[model samples]
Target: MKLDKVSAGYHKKIVVRDVNFEVSPGEIIGIIGPNGGGKSTLLKSINGSLSLIGGSIFLDDLDVSGASAKEIAGCMSVVTTERVKPILMTCRDVVSAGRIPFTNGFGTLKEEDNARIDRAMELMKIKELSDIPYADVSDGQKQRTLIARAIAQDPKYLVMDEPTSYMDIRHRFELMELLKRLAKEGMTIVASLHELELALSYCDRLLLVYGDGHVQLKTPDEVLSEDLLKELFDLSGDMYRKVLRSVRGEKEEGSTSFFVNRACKSFPCHDVPESEFNCMFCYCPLYDTEDCGGDYFYNDRNIKNCKNCGFPHFRDNYPKVIKKLKEKMYGSGSQE
Candidate 1:
């Protein structure tokens, strides 16, 4: 499937424009951007929810411009992160809904439907959750069930929006692995991911929407290496690495504890009465040299060397100090 000169929006106000992309028969594509950047809007456009204002989408040679809902359903299956309506039924029943596209209006199930249902469960490795109440399962299990349902539909293209939104890090990786496997097995997968690293590693192509009008569709390496992310996100300095870094796992090795300057603040140090927390920070050259007037951030790039400070190990609630410090740091202090 390919999106050609597609401009999608609501009413008359355009959200994202001039998006041209192609999905191979068995490739994984990732659409990434900050919030309100129209990732979801583009997904909806292909999922048959949002109408396109210009350009045409093609599934192989067929035009998507005038396709009916059912006809489109025959080509693509979708699993959105939006909370699916809870049907008062077992997990099996909910996963069975994927077969509805194959069913006639009256909803008759064939032997192929049962075979596909079994394949879906086996593919998701959710035979254990089959008898469990759909509502009773964990979010990860539910997500897998919905994915299984989509697989059961047996559509050529699979569209997912934040499929791992409810999953933990472990489950998120697991889900990505599963999607990659499926793509290798001949399913066209398009997803919008908040996880940059995972997307860069798994997706063959990238679509970055910078909102309003700017959009870039390129190979993952090209987009990630060309400062496109920095421009798209308006980031600079060390913070730029937060976006400019490759989505794949290629981070540089550094100390887990960032060096501190002489007077620079640490996590949350409260002025306690005599004794609360007690720990000696590793001293750096700046402290002995008196570069920072006994502050932690002295003359080092790592902000090392602090003046020796003491605490009595008193009892200050960690949460309260953390809350107040965060409030101070992110609050009106900077502007004032």
Candidate 2:
């Protein structure tokens, strides 16, 4: 897929301008930016859902602007953020609609179409819900059913807007893994992601859309090393530092994870090294955990006393502390 000097927006107003990029086969291109930065507008332009205000987009040699709806649908499948209200349609019925482009005018499904629909449901792990009404399931399940519908289309290119929007942490990772596998199988994918960590880890390249209508295409490393995300998102110094650490999965110099306050009278609260003490978590996050990996004991009234625990204050225990907190909040298998 290729976009050349594309400008996209609603009505006559332009939201994103002068966008130029090309997505090669099997490449995962992530579109990331602040909210309302026209990521969805750009994607709609590329997918031919919205008419381009200027410039052109091409899928292979086929010009998107000139292509018929069926012609475009034959090569590209889209999963937009819009919620579908299918009246009385079963999940399987919704998925079967993906084969419409290849079906006869009467909308009769062939055996091959049925097979593809079933396979798509299975791949999305929604086969059990196939018979349920589309309106009855949860938002996450609806999103998965839509994704399965897109997969059932079997198009060469897949475009998605916030594909992980309604999914839980585990399902979000699962969906990204599935996209990776699909890309490996030669399906080019372009998606807008709100999760910066997933975008940094999974996308081969990022299409950054700035709020000022400027866009840049860069590799993940370039986006990180150049500090483009901070500028793009308009983050403060401290928030930017935290975002950097979160995406890189490494603690950098002057990281937000480590802090010290020496002015307090009880400064050396823990018996640990003052230089390595992290005051970020001044109060132990695991204080409520019954089996917290810390030196804690019950007081005379059976109330827990965490004053002797230094687990949260240790510099090296930041990740451990965060892990314990997340486990307490969302269970051990959670990724959020």
Candidate 3:
């Protein structure tokens, strides 16, 4: 896939400009930046969903700008974050839609198309839910079903928008792994991600889109520097320093995690049911310092027992953590 000096946005309003990148088969490219930085706009342009304001996009030898919808669908499959309210469709029905590009005008499914759907459901680990109503499934399950739908399309390129938004940490990693496997099997993948850590770890390349209309394609190592992150997200000096330290693994030795949480009783105050919610820290700010110094041991069941330390719960200790982390990163307050 190639984007040559592309510019894209809504209704003639430019969001991303001069975006040039070429990706090969079996590579995963991640588009990342702050909110409204044009990540989605760029993806839409590449997938031929949104018409480009300038330049051109080519999928191999085919011109994406001039291709018909059917031609584009045959070459590229899209999985969006938008929820599809399928009135009476089953999960199998959704996955089967992917075969529409190859189907006849009568929309009859061949045996191979059914086989592809079955394989896709199995790959997404949604075979059990294939017969289930799409409306009855959880958000994470719905995401997986949609991904399966894309997989069944068997397109050369797969595009997604925040595919991990509804997943827990486990399933988030699982989906990344699945995408990597699919890429290795010869599919080109492009997706936008808010999870910087996951993007750095999983994607072969990163496309940074600045809100000011600056865009650049670089490797993960080249794009993840402190200066670049600050510029891309327009972060403050303090926030950038803290993020830099965290990314460099320069935390206070004993501080495992630090977060302020509202102690709402109804908000999973005991255990974490999903990765989006951190119930462990709900009462971290109120823990008995004398009982726990913030150190804990995980037992066979992976249950935490932080009854000997309070290292991460002290709100007043943030400055100390920052100081220590900064010291570790830049060598004991010696400014660079």
Candidate 4:
């Protein structure tokens, strides 16, 4: 799919201009920037929801400008940020709606359609909620159901806006993984994301819509610079650096502590509190380290378990932890 010199927006008003890019099969592209940067408007242009003020979009030889709604629906599916309130409609019924383009005039589902719907629900892990009304489901569940609908549509390209907005951390991770799997299976995906980490980790390329109709298209690594991010979001210096460091796994010197306790009866919630038990390192700074040599394991839910690790509790280990953290923060043997 290709967009050439595209300018688009609501009726007679242009929000984004000169947007150009070609999407390859199986590539995942993420659109990101500050609010009102015309991300959604650009998406609308690609999906044919908003009319293009100038230029054109093409899906191979088929001109997007000329394609009928039904023809376009056959190749593209979109999950927008707009919440859909489905009255008296079950989740199954909602997912089945994706087949409208392929269904007969009366919208009857065939055996193949049922199989596709079943597969989509299973893929989204909403099979059990299929019978529940859409209005009764939680926001996260509803989001998943809508995603299931998109999947049931079986379009060659899938587009989503703020897909993870209502999802919990676990669901966010799961959904990204699912999208990656789908992309590997040859579906092109274009999405607008608020989570920079997820976008950096998942997208093959990123289109940054910095308001005033400016857009920059680049790979994640190319656009992950500190200055660009700070400018894009209008972040202050300290915060911009802090956010960058956190995402890059570089700990600031004072971000963690060695030992100190304010007022605590329990002192140690897991076991008897040692007089010297330090509350400073209550949350281990090295929790994110893969080979910190601490005795740690992940629980059933994949949460890190450091209950038996005495590395952070012992007062003497404070200096060593700090040293390791500093080393991680400022590379090994560099003046700290």
Top of the candidates by TM-score: 4
Q: Ranking by TM-score, best first?
A: 4, 2, 3, 1
Predicted structure with the largest lDDT when compared to the true one: 2
Better of 2 and 3 by TM-score: 2
Q: Rate the local accuracy (lDDT) of all candidates.
A: 0.73, 0.88, 0.80, 0.82
TM-score, every prediction: 0.71, 0.76, 0.73, 0.76
Clash pairs (backbone) in predicted model 2: none
Clashing pairs in model 4, backbone N/Cα/C closer than 3 A = none
* Residue 226's lDDT in candidate 1: 81
lDDT of 1 by residue, 1-336 (tens): 989999988996678899887777998989888888888988888887888888888888767768888888887899897877586767888788898988978888889998999888888888888888899998888888998889888878999998878777777777888888888889899999888777777789888889566688787788767867776666776777755544433322112222223364542232333233322222222233333244343433443434442311233333343344455558745675
User: What lDDT would candidate 1 get against the real structure?
Assistant: 0.73
Q: Is candidate 2 or candidate 4 better by TM-score?
A: 4
lDDT of 4 by residue, 1-336 (tens): 999999988887889888899999999999999899898998888888887899999987778888988888999999999999978999999999988888999999999999999999999999999889999999999999999999999989998888888999788878988999999999999999998878877899999888778788888888775357777787899988786776454222123434345465534443325655566555556765463655666666555556545355565677887776777778888555
Q: After superposition, how far is residue 330 of candidate 2 from its true place, in Å?
A: 34
Let me know the TM-score candidate 1 reaches against the reference structure.
0.71
Compute the lDDT of residue 40 as modeled in candidate 1: 90
Task: Encode model 2's per-residue lDDT on 209-232: one tens digit a residue.
Answer: 999888999998899899999999
lDDT of 3 by residue, 1-336 (tens): 988988899999999999888999999999889998888888888888899999999999989989998889988999887889998889999999999999999999999999999999999899999789999999999989999999999989999999988888788878888999999999999999988777877899988888888898888788765368888888999998886666554222213354324555344333333433443454343243443344455555554435445444344545554554455557765556
Model 3 lDDT, full chain set: 0.80
